[model samples]
Target: MRIATTILVMLATTLPAAAAGQAADHRVLPFTPSGQGDPQAVVCRAPQKLENAEGYGPEICLRNGIWILLTQDAKDLAADGRSVFKRPLVEEPHGNGPAEAVTCRKPPTITASRTWRGPVVCLENRVWASLYERGLTVTGDGRLVSTRMSGPATDPTGMPVIQTTPPPRDAPVIGGYYSPL
Candidate 1:
């Protein structure tokens, strides 16, 4: 009876530790995208740790339909040890008409520049714009000085520039014949 009681106690303590260890080694399941599926219908893996760099996280589904995983480098602890960070691809619609209307519920990501600093605003159409601060007084030589506008700036072009979304790294290539493993 004592032996059985000791076994139960050991299991009670060890099981929780084992379960925690398993949780720490979290990995995302594989995904196969359908040809004619909606872009919003896609899902990716969840991040394991909270200490992720900007624009890159584990199991994050990028706008290009790829799942990105940033794993720690077991080797090379000093130089190039961290994973690469990539911004999501965005495609803007083209028109001679007025600039596409955009609204932000939260502050957008700020991208710093030597000439001009601005915010990268993601629009409702999933398009992103790198807009310059409006009403900034510039020198005769074109250096930015001060701004009369407040909050985030607006696109100087009156039309926001859009970028094209790229495909996932592991996505199948067209016209290339290869055998599936």
Candidate 2:
């Protein structure tokens, strides 16, 4: 009986350590809704592939180092390079309410390689914007600054969109590259 109890205690201690190690490697990206508009922008981890998925739309990685799923209509607007910060706020056509605007600062420097530091913006019920291929640099004040890309923006359809199954709940936001704004 003493041996069994010792083993149980050992298991309990090791289990937590093991879990913490795994957690350390995994990133938690929480869904942060920005606007007051209806059908709030849904941000979550995207599946590895978007092929033939019903209701699911295009995805983009935010400056916060998290992936988010956008509504179809919102996807369309983002594809056009429109940002809530650049455009005037307006009411949703469906009369849900005034659209909420999201703004992100441009990265301070541009790089030739893929990076998580880029501009990201979204409006409630309207659009989701991102600067693909751009790198991000966090300022001393914790603001996300954008960097320039070595090349011109690629075709939106050609951007690297990884596929992964959506988690049941929003993951906790993690990673060193967080949005300063």
Candidate 3:
């Protein structure tokens, strides 16, 4: 009983600070996109009117709930709902070449397995990356394999960007593949 009372007292003191922090975040990032359909990816671009950054990613476009999410990376559509939180994700594609990839200098989700967040390409600095993982080899008779994963992607700006999502060591890559095993 005593411990419970002490805990309540602590909450009474910190509750105000927590509320203030959330209010500040809301004020700083007021615009959020509306979307619904299996949270995939999101981007927070320099907002201008209602239109946000197009091309190159899940840029913020419209308003949704408390938090904003990106639904369609191409059309810049806003998500309809908010995840428990946003996920910082990386896009590496292997649909183009055996080792072609583009490395997004941002934080990404740490999925249980490999995640293909974007198309395969070679960036200016030549950072090999892919949205797909495994290799061109598949269980089927010489066919590219792909899978649709469903999960909530956390926000990076609100959260701290941690260790690089991509491999620490640069190496050759290939794409158009998935693994159920």
All candidates: TM-score: 0.16, 0.16, 0.18
Candidate 3 per-residue lDDT over residues 84-163, each given as its tens digit: 22222234323443222212222233344765333222221122223343323221222345454323333433343233
Q: Which numbered prediction scores highest in TM-score against the true structure?
A: 3
* Candidate 2 per-residue lDDT over residues 27-119, each given as its tens digit: 322222342333322222222232355443323222221112222112222221122112332321221333333433333334557434433
lDDT at 118 for candidate 2? 35
RMSD of each: 24.7, 25.9, 20.9
lDDT of 1 by residue, 1-181 (tens): 4454444334324433444434434332232111122432333233334353444233333211122111111000111112333234222222122233222222223344645423332232222122222334323333445444333222453433332344457977532333445
Top-scoring candidate (lDDT): 2
Estimate the TM-score for candidate 1: 0.16
Candidate 2 Cα deviation (angstroms), residue 151: 43
Query: Which residues of candidate 3, in runs, are more than 4 Å off?
Result: 1-43, 48-73, 77-133, 136-181
Q: For each candidate, what is the lDDT?
A: 0.30, 0.32, 0.30
Q: Which whole-number lDDT from 0 to 100 does residue 138 have in model 2?
A: 42
Measured with C-alpha atoms, the lDDT of residue 21 in candidate 3 is 34
Rank the models by lDDT, top first: 2, 3, 1
